[model samples]
Each structure stands twice: as structure tokens, then as C-alpha cells.
Target: MPITLADKLVVAISSRALFDFEEENRLFERSDAATYLQLQRERLEVPAQRGIAFSLVQKLLAFNTPQMQRVEVVILSRNDPVSGLRVFHSAEAAGIALQRGVFTQGRPPFGYLRPLGAHLFLSANADDVTEALGLGYPAAHVYTDSVQASLAHPNELRIAFDGDAVLFSDEAERIYQAEGLEAFQRHETDRHGQPLPDGPFKPLLAALHRLQQIADAVPGMRIRTALVTARSAPAHKRAIQTLMSWDIAVDEAMFLGGLSKGPFLKEFEPDFFFDDQTGHVHNAAQHVPAGHVRSGFASAMVETTATIRKHQDQG
Candidate 1:
């Protein structure tokens, strides 16, 4: 018989996303690889600080018990093998049970997602994030410098997401981009009863919901989700309706009406937050462990065009 990942909720994350390496990353960026490798070797014994998705990885792994292996998290990193040594050491110091890893040594690691049966991939590299999304995998570019979530919610995993383009399709965003805000509002107001289409991170949300249900039965852990979007008033209705259509429920919903999401997110203190737009992602990153979902009408529409052209040529 052979071992298989068929039944696990697997997550593939990068060293940068899992542990703080911003200072080291800057060295890699400014100087050469040799210098970075030497530095990593020198400080191999020093465990790195917990990164953006640390709490997330920690909570999800808690679902695994001796009798039931409910989750699997693998280190899929672009860091060289030497730096990877520190990543493992840091995880061990943090008391996380990480058993597998792939050190790409500066190459893109997205290609391994399929082989790993990864339900989600989190990295700090935008290019890797984009590539993963194009392949239709759920991935996010973690904001490694973001403020970590509060210690208050120790037994609970708090996640927040943007509405359109992250959880729901970017249909309304496309409209807003083409027309003005008024037209976008009017459009949603008219069709508030209609559910928005599915977006990239919806499946992840559903998975978390299911995990919450399982945890609910056990009583020791919980998963809390929130919809923190720029849409407000009438436009907010469609986002809510979409979740209803999908039979999804979020613990909190904030329709900020084009305001800065940073302050609100600081108050919410999610373990992790996902948004599509760069501005929103960076803003919330300052206040919470945030990741850019990198999917929407613009990116997805181009992907659709390429697919359509290929199909036509094949036909």
C-alpha cells in the first residue's frame, strides 16, 4: 500500500509566510545569495519570530489528534536549503509539528502544489501567488511584516476576507471600475436579491466553516470568519446574499463603504485576512496578518481570454 494525501485538509506555506524573515529577505534582495546563505548559517540557532500566518498554521494543526489527522501543513519555500534549516528550527521552537518541507533554493515553488494535494498555498512572493492563482489553486501572498493577531483568541481562529474578488466574483468590481460609484451602487441596489458569483477564496471559507463544525462538536477550538469589504449600503446586500446562496455563514460582516480598512481590522485582530486589491491588502497588513488573494476580473478575465483562444484554436 502507499500513503496518500487524499483525505487531509492540506496547506502548503512558505518559510517567509510562516516565520518572520523580512530582515534576512532584505539582505537577499540587496546583496547576493552567498551573503544571505552565510547569514542564515550564522544565525541557524536563533529561532525566527512568528510570521503572518503562524497563528493560522498553529490553529489548523490543532485539529489533528492521535486518532484523527484532520490537517496537514507542509513547508514549500523559495529559500535556499541553508535558510530552510532555520525555518524548521523556528517551527520546532514555536512548538509546531511540521514534518515535511521543500526548499526550492530561490526557484518558484508553485509547481509542487498539485503533487501535495494542497488546498491552500501561502507565500510572500507575489509571482508565486499569481502563478498559483492562474493554475486555479487557492493561494495568497502573505504580508510577513503585518501585525500578528491578538493572544486573546487563543482557542479560536479568526479570519477576515474582502467580499468581491476575494470571496465573491469581481462582477460588481468590474462594473464599479468601468462606471462610477453611483452606477455600481445602483446596479447592486437593483439586483441586491441576486447572489454574486463565486470567487477564489470561497472554497477556503467553506473549508474553514466545515472545520468549525467539527471543532464545535469537540468544544476546545473554534473558527471565526468575517466579511470586511469596501462595499456598503445597497452594494453590501449582494455580498450577504451570495454567502446565503452558498449556505456560508460568517461571524462578522463589515461594509466599510470605501473607507480605510486598517483601523477596523486592528480592532477585529484576525489571525489572517485576505483581500484582492493591493491597497486594501497593504493597509490591513499593517493591522493584521494579511494576504493578497490576487484574483479578480482583471487577472481572471485575461486568464479566461487565453483559455477561450486556446479552445477556439483546438476547435
Candidate 2:
């Protein structure tokens, strides 16, 4: 078969995002999320091998037999220990336990393909990944979906994210955490009419927005998006305003309040869910793909995994 363009989807993930979550927390808080992850991947001298999501990304890439294949991993850091390290190294190491020859032989299905330079190709850098594909990749380029269901065929690639701290400014979150309910509500009410500043997820959102623009212009361009948030009504208003300010289109938005969000998530289904709180992530993981984003906040960083785990267990 001629290598048809319809048989593959590309998921770009940072080394840290794919690595072990337990140990990375300390570093995640001390620095920026990307910096923390990049450092973790470099210092550990190993790719992240813990989470189910990491394993799934590897499976999609290595198992090229099926029509739904994936090619993931790209180095985006400018300066770091693992900056120059091979992107495939992480994949190979993680694959060793599964199939010995898989990583070493550079298996036909999934192996280290080649380098995608910053401007030339998306390098897993949120900004770069989004910008490069804004024009639209011949392949489907999605950020937030975990199941990769969005790309049912090899053609479409999907991306997913957890709302709140991931896409919008964590400022509102900070208020909620520090000030408690009344203060948090008051602050949100005060800021109701105004849009929140772009949070860490902005770079990616901008990239998706650009892609949406192109998709709008061109026919048969397969690009999609969703905003799965824990924010409820009234609180959800800011998210809408923020996106409006940026002029980004979210194909779907789920404002899940105190309600068990997992059911809704499973129904909407995403490639991934990025949330700052483990409480939400734990439940969401059971249904759909999920990733935890450490706010790089002191309180969150200070909390031990045991504690977070315990809290989740309790919930």
C-alpha cells in the first residue's frame, strides 16, 4: 500500500507531560510547567513511564498495523539537559518493557522518525505546535483528546485539555483557593463583565484558533476543539468572555459544576483532560483520557502526592 496520508494522526506531547507524575511535582512547582517537565525528563535521564495516557500514546505510535496510527514526541525546549536529547529516546525507553526490539530497531510502526525544528515543524512547544498547524497540517492536529477517538481513522489527530487553570488565567483559581467561597464569589462577581487574562493554555488555544480560521477558509480541513471545564454557571461566564476576547471557537464547552463530571466527560469524550487538581483528574481518568497540570502554586506543590491521593480516595 502506498503510505496513504489517511492512516495516521499526530499527537505532540512534551517529555514531562509523558513522564512519571509522582516525582515531578517538586520541580513542577519551583518553575514553569514546561520548564519543570523538560527538566524532569532531562535529569531523570529517562522518559516518563508511569501513567496510562503515556502508554496509550506509545501504543498508537508503535502499532502502525491498524489504520489508526500515531506519531508523537518532539523536543521544544531551547536550553535544557534534555533539550538536545532525542525525542525517540523517551519513547524507546518506555517501549523496552513492552517489546524489546521495538525501540531499538526503530520499528516500522512507531519509532524515532526525525527532528522537527522549531519553525520548520511543530516541536511539542505549545506555541510552536499551535502556530505550525494553524495553517493546518495535512494530518489531523488536535491537542486535548485522550482516547484519540476524534481521529477514528488514521487521518484525524485530536488534542484535549482541562479547563480553568489550563486555558484561562489561574488568577480566579488562586482567589478561590486563598479567599474561600464568599471572597471568591465576590471577586468573580466583580470581574464578571471582564474577561480573564489568558492562562497557560493560551498559546495552544491561539494555535487552535488560527487552525479554525483556516478550516473556515478551506474545505475538508479537519480541525476541532472542546473546552471541558469544572466551572459552573455564573463562574462559567468568565470562560466564555475570555474566549470571546481571544476570538477562539470551542466546538464544545461543558460547564460541569459540583456534579460528577466524569459521565459528561465520557459522553463528550476528549483526547485528554488537563486539570490542576488531582481530585478532578482521578475521576475523569476512569472515563476518558486525563492529565494533571500543576498550577505551579505553592499550596498545590506543597501538598504531597499521598495527601492528594488520599483526598481523591476520600472523595
Candidate 3:
């Protein structure tokens, strides 16, 4: 029989996203790969600090039991094999049971997501995330400097997602951006009964939904999700209608209109939040762990590609 990740909720993460490698990353930025590799080798025995996504990964991994394994986390990193030893060591020190990994030695690692059947791809590399998103995977650029997740929801995996772009197609967002608020609202109002097109994160949300159903039989295990968006009233109706059409239900929904999302996300205290807009993601990161979805109407793929090329040159 062949081994497969088909039945599990697989999450592929980068070493930097899963651990606090910012200091080493800074060294990489200032020096050469050899210098960085030496530093990692020197610190091989020390466990890296927990990163912004650490808590989320910890809770998600807890869904697995000796009798049933519901989740699989794979390290999909740009670090060389030597540096990867530290990533695995850190996971063990943190009590996170990660058994699979792919080390690409500074190359973009998104290509492996297809074979992993990853429901989510979280990384510190914007170029890799952008490439994964381009390939139709749910990928996010982890805000490394973002505040860590709250400890309040120890037994629950709480995730929040923006409506447009993150959860649904950027179709209406493009309209909103090009035509302005009044026109966007009117268009949504007229099409309130129609379901919006699926977005990149939809598959991840669906996978989470299935995981939630499976968690029902496990005591003290829970998964809560939210729809946090800037749309309100007329525009909000279509968002809800779309979720209904897809048969997915979120535990909470915040239609913030045009207000800043930071304070509201602080109150929600999600393990993580995803938004396509850099501004929204930056704001949310001030309060909760947040990632920038590099796909949608506001995608900065060109900028990300340039960044990737620059890094490759540095590597």
C-alpha cells in the first residue's frame, strides 16, 4: 500500500514562519549564505523561539490522537538541509510532532505543495507565497513581527479570514476598488441573491470545516472560524449568501464597513487571521497573528517576484 496525505488536514509551513528565525534572517540579510549556515550550525543544539504561527500549529497538531490522526504538518522551507535539522529540533523542543519536511536550499519551495495536498501554506517568504497562490493554493506570507496568538483558546483552533479575496473571489473587490464605495455597494445590492465566485482560501476553509466535523467526536477539541470584512449591509448580504450557497458556516462575522480591523481583531483574538490587503494585514498583526494573502485584486505579485529574484541573487 502507498502512503498518502489525502485523508489528513495537511499544513505546509516554512521554518521561519514556524519559529523565530528573524535574528538569523537578519544575519542572512546582512551577510552571505555561508555565514548564515555557520550561525545555524553553531546554534544547532539550541531550540529556536516560538514564532507568530507556533501557537496555531501546536493546537492544530493536538487534534491527532494515538487512535486517530486528523492533522499532518510538513515543513516546506527554503533553508538547506543542515539548517533544517534545527527546524526539526525546535519543533521537538516545542512539543510539536512534525515528521515530514522538504528543504529546498533557498529555492522557492511552493512546488512541493501539490504533492503534499496542503490545505494551507504559511511562510515568511512573500515570493514563495505569491507563487503558491498563483498555482491556486491557499498561501499566506506570515507577518514575522506580528504579535503571537492568545492563550485563551488553548483547546480551540481559532482562525479568522477576510471576506473578499481571502474567502471569496476578488471580483467585487476589483469593482469596489475601481468604481468606489457607492458603486460597489449598489452592485452588491443588486446581486445580493447571487453567490460570489470561490476564492483561493475557500479550499482551506472547507478543509477546516471538515476537520471541525471530525472534531465533534473528540472531547474538548474545537475549531472556530470567522468572517471579518470591511463590507457592510448591502455588500454584506452577498457575502453571507455566498457562504450559504457553499454550505459553510462561520462562528462569527464582523462587517466593519470602513473601520480599521485592528481593534476588532484584538477582541476576536484569533490564532491567526488572513487578509489580502497589506494594510489590513499590517493593522491586524498589531493585535493578532496575521498573514497577507498575496492573491486577489490587490496582489503585489510583480513586487514579490522582484523580491524573490533579489533573494535568489543573494543566495
Candidate 4:
């Protein structure tokens, strides 16, 4: 029988997203691929430092046990196979059990996300992330320089997500962007009973919810999710109703009503926080590990559209 990832919560991560390769990356940018490959080869025995997404990956991997493997983390990198040696070595040194990988030698690796059945794709390359999101996968551009994960919750994997353009479609956000707060509030209030459409991250959130259920049976394993949004009061009702309609619930919800999300996220101390807006992502990155979900509204939508057109042209 062939092995399958049908029942697993699979995450496809790039080498830069998983470990600290900023220096090597800078070299690759400054010099050439051959020079970068040589640098990686010289440092083959040196384990790479943990990057922004390391803690999240490490915690998720903890869900796996000898009895039953509930999670799978694969290296979906653009580095050549030769450079991949350092990546695998680093994972081993860090005690992360990563057994599968794809080294595309500078080629876009998002194509393999389908074969991997990945629930999430984290990479430092914004173009690749945008393309993956355009393809309807839950993908994010990991902020490599973002603050590291907190040690406060060792046994728990805590994740936080923004509401509009993230867990739900950017429908309300488009309204707010175009018609101002009063109109947006009125719209939400009127449609409080109707569920908002699913966002790109909705699939990833659903996958995490399933993982939470599975963790309930595994001793000492836990997953907690939070909806940290700018929606407040009347607008919050629809967001909650939408999750309820989908039969999913977040462990916590924060409707900040346009308050700066950074301080609040600092208090929550999530392993990772994801938002669609660059401003929110950068602000949250100052306090905790954060990623930008490049989908829905403004620039994200623009990028997604361009990627779709690019693919269509290729096809």
C-alpha cells in the first residue's frame, strides 16, 4: 500500500522559514547561486539557528508520537539538493523529525504543495506565498525577523488569526476600505445573522480545529486558537456567527475595534499570529512571531490577481 497524507495535518515550510539563513540568503542575493551553494557546503556540519517559524513547527511536530503520527512537516525549499544537506542536518540537530522534502534549486516550489496535501505553506518568499494563496492553499509569508515564540506555553501550540481577509473573506474589509466605518458597521449589523464567506486561511483554521480534537486524546498535547480581530460590538456578532455556522470555535476572540493589535497579541503570546495587512503583521511581529496571509483586499488581492493571470498565460 502506498503511504498517504490524507489524514495528517501537513505543513510545507521553506528552509529560510524553518531556520535562520539570512546571512546565506544575503550572500545568494549579493553574489550568485554557485557562491551560495559553496557557503552552505562549507557550513554543512553547523546546525542552522532557529528562524521565526521554528517554534511553531517544533510544537506541531510534538503532536506526533510513535503510536500514531498526527502531523507531518516537510521542507518545501527552493535551495538546491546540495544546500538541502544543511537543512536536514539542522533539523536533526534541533531534534525535529522531518523525513520528507523537495529541493527545487531556485525554482518555485509551491507546485508541490498539492502533492503534499499541505494544510499550510510557510515561506519567506512573498511571490511564492502569493502564488500558493492564489492557488487556494493556506499560505503565508513568514516574517523571518519577527520575534521568536514564547516559552510560556511549552505543551501548548497557540495560534492567533485576524478575522476579515484571514479567517473570513475580505467582504467587510472591502466595505470598510471603501465606505468608511459607519457604512461597514451598518452592513455588519444588518447581516449579523448571515455567515461571512470563507477566507484563504479558513482551511488552515479548520485543519487546526481538527488537530485540536485529535490532541484531546493525546496526553500532554494541546492546541489553542484565537481570533484577534479589529471588529467590535455589532460587527463582532457576524464574525462569531460565521464560526458558529461553520461549526468551529476559537479558544479566544478579541474584537479590538481598530485598537493596535500588537500589545494585545503581546499579552496573548501566540506561537504565531497571521494577518492579511502588512501594517498589522509588522506591528505584531515586534511582539510575537507573525506572518502575512497574502489574500483578499487591496495589495493582496492585486498580487493574487496577477499570479492568476500569470498562471493563465502559462497554461
For candidate 4, write residues 148-198 as lDDT tens digits. Answer: 999999999999999998989999999998999999999999999999999
Q: Is candidate 2 or candidate 3 better by lDDT?
A: 3
Show how many residue pairs clash in every candidate, following the order shown: 0, 17, 0, 0
Off by over 4 Å in 3: 300-315
Residue 128 lDDT, candidate 1, scale 0-100: 96
lDDT of 3 by residue, 104-221 (tens): 9988899999999999999999889989999999999999989999998898999999989989999998898789999999999999999999999999999999989889767898
List TM-scores for all candidates, in order. 0.90, 0.53, 0.95, 0.95
User: What lDDT does the true structure give each of the candidates?
Assistant: 0.88, 0.50, 0.93, 0.94
Residue 88 of model 1, lDDT score = 92
> Of the candidates numbered 2 and 4, which has the greater lDDT value?
4
User: lDDT for model 4, on a 0 to 1 scale?
Assistant: 0.94
Candidate 3 clashing pairs? none
The per-residue C-alpha lDDT of model 4 at residue 232 equals 97
**Candidate with better TM-score, 1 vs 3:** 3
Candidate 4 local lDDT, residue 222:
91
